[model samples]
Target: MPVLSTVGGSGRSTVAGLLACALSAMGSTVVLDTGPRLSSPWPAWSSEPGTGLLSLPPDRPLTRGQVHAAASRFPAPDGGSWQVLTDHQEWSHPPLPLPSDPAAWYQLSAIGGWQAVIADTVHPVAHDVLTARWADSTGLTARWCHLPFSVPVLCAASTGSGVLALQTAVKAASAEGLPLHRMVVALAAVGEGRSPASVKAAATMLEPRVRAVVQVPYDPRIRAHGIRDTSRLKSRSLEAGRQLARAVVSSAEAAWGDPLPAAAVPRTRAAAQARVHDTARIASKKVPA
Candidate 1:
């Protein structure tokens, strides 16, 4: 599934990285960086830094067979195979342009044999070219939103702006006959912001619209460094990342019916949201005065 944000700076990239790493630890995984940027976080903390999708020539038409042939395996903690397909160029001065056609990239990835393919998209509405294309091709896209109460959280806009962008994304998906099925809401407590009650209330508003809602808790370390900098993550942050990963895995299985290895049973929606509320408390408790 392609992971996208309604607005920029929604921690979508961070969530994408965590999800990719977690799935990689479980089984075969591939992460494709489709964001239009000079740099990507995946290479910073990735076990194998140099190997990426950039190895494939941008001048030529990309194919699934070509992508599979170019894919490089990265080491996961569980001794599983993790492949990272980054679009960042090795040359720092002149950055290479990421592929413009999201459809082709999605097709290439769909053909490749990867348990899960997470594409870190820029945005679903204004600046994004990937999610619209992905949604059109697959009729589905997973949105990652933080601070859904119309408040500014990270680099993203207010919750209202994010929701508006989400509506646009949903419309695009609907045009393709695939209404959005799942969404991941990050209740990040970066500062003294929304209360747990308010967060839950916001989630409540969204629960009825989507099939599954994955809630990611705020981890201060993630806010500080980045998701790729796993070394800087504390116990709470690490646990949060693990929890987010598990949610992604479970959601993917439910959405695609892809057989996942035996793991914890997926939690009920109410139970999962309750955990998110509990996470808000833990995050607040751990915050420095």
Candidate 2:
């Protein structure tokens, strides 16, 4: 299972939802809202309110049957299926379920063969549980952790402290030898125009710790409406969201040495070629016209 932990403020819920949407679009079965409290309803979970990811009995090791049963609940888009697990009870203390052994918790997750697990772990209990798990296992990979591109995003009146807490958690994970795949820097609000300078500065500051920095431009629809299960997003915003999601998936694929499907290879190459041609044309036009 490829698990991608999303660490950010309340805004992270939107990112997690968008990431799940992107993976689903690519034909990958993705489990969303695996944490205690689901941030958004996108990629809806079938588990009843009282039962969630954290509710599973730690004494009884998770079995393939249980995995299948849990997965059966969430009907995947287009015919495929993805397991959607929530945290037991809307909120709980860290180390969800209070796993007697932290390693067992991760082992259970690894058994699912999940292509990706996007968690919006913003609360203290959620953060503590994740931190403990990361501490217990030095071998697990840290795909990406989302952050704000500017101070304003962190200081915004509505913003919470989860962003800062997530940063600290990432730092701790990095010190333990887990690779920080990338730091996704998102703007505080949409339609605020591109803040290139802030984005660049954020990338520079985070470069030392992460493999790369990804900039997710402010998309008003995401901020205004929040995550939704349907595919009725504004066309422009949907396109932009897809672009960011593609970049993240591509990076993850490269890290894991996974090959893109044969059907997608040609299209991927053509897209690369188109970018090159576009760049060349821009340079040529700037020469004299």
Could you give me the TM-score of model 2 versus the true structure?
Answer: 0.52
After superposition, the stretches of candidate 1 with alpha carbons farther than 4 Å from their true spots are 45-47, 58-81, 88-93, 110-112, 126-178, 192-198, 229-232, 252-289
Each prediction's TM-score against the native?
0.62, 0.52
Candidate 1: how large is its RMSD? 18.0
The collision pairs in model 2 are 35-87, 36-87, 53-86, 95-129
User: What are the per-residue Cα lDDT tens digits for candidate 1 across 1-289?
Assistant: 5566656656677666666656776666777777644545655545545435656664455556677656555554445556667654455545755665555455456556565666666644433335446544331232222111111112222255444565555455445444344444444444444445544555576557554444555667667666554555555555655766665555556654667443222233457689999999898885667
Q: List the residue pairs that clash in candidate 1.
A: 150-159, 150-160, 151-159
Relative to the unseen true structure, what is the C-alpha lDDT of residue 186 in candidate 2, on a scale of 0 to 100?
40
- Per-residue lDDT of candidate 2, residues 182-245 (tens digit): 4343433334554545444544666575544434445555565554332445555445446546
Give Cα-based local distance difference scores for all models: 0.53, 0.43
TM-score of 1: 0.62
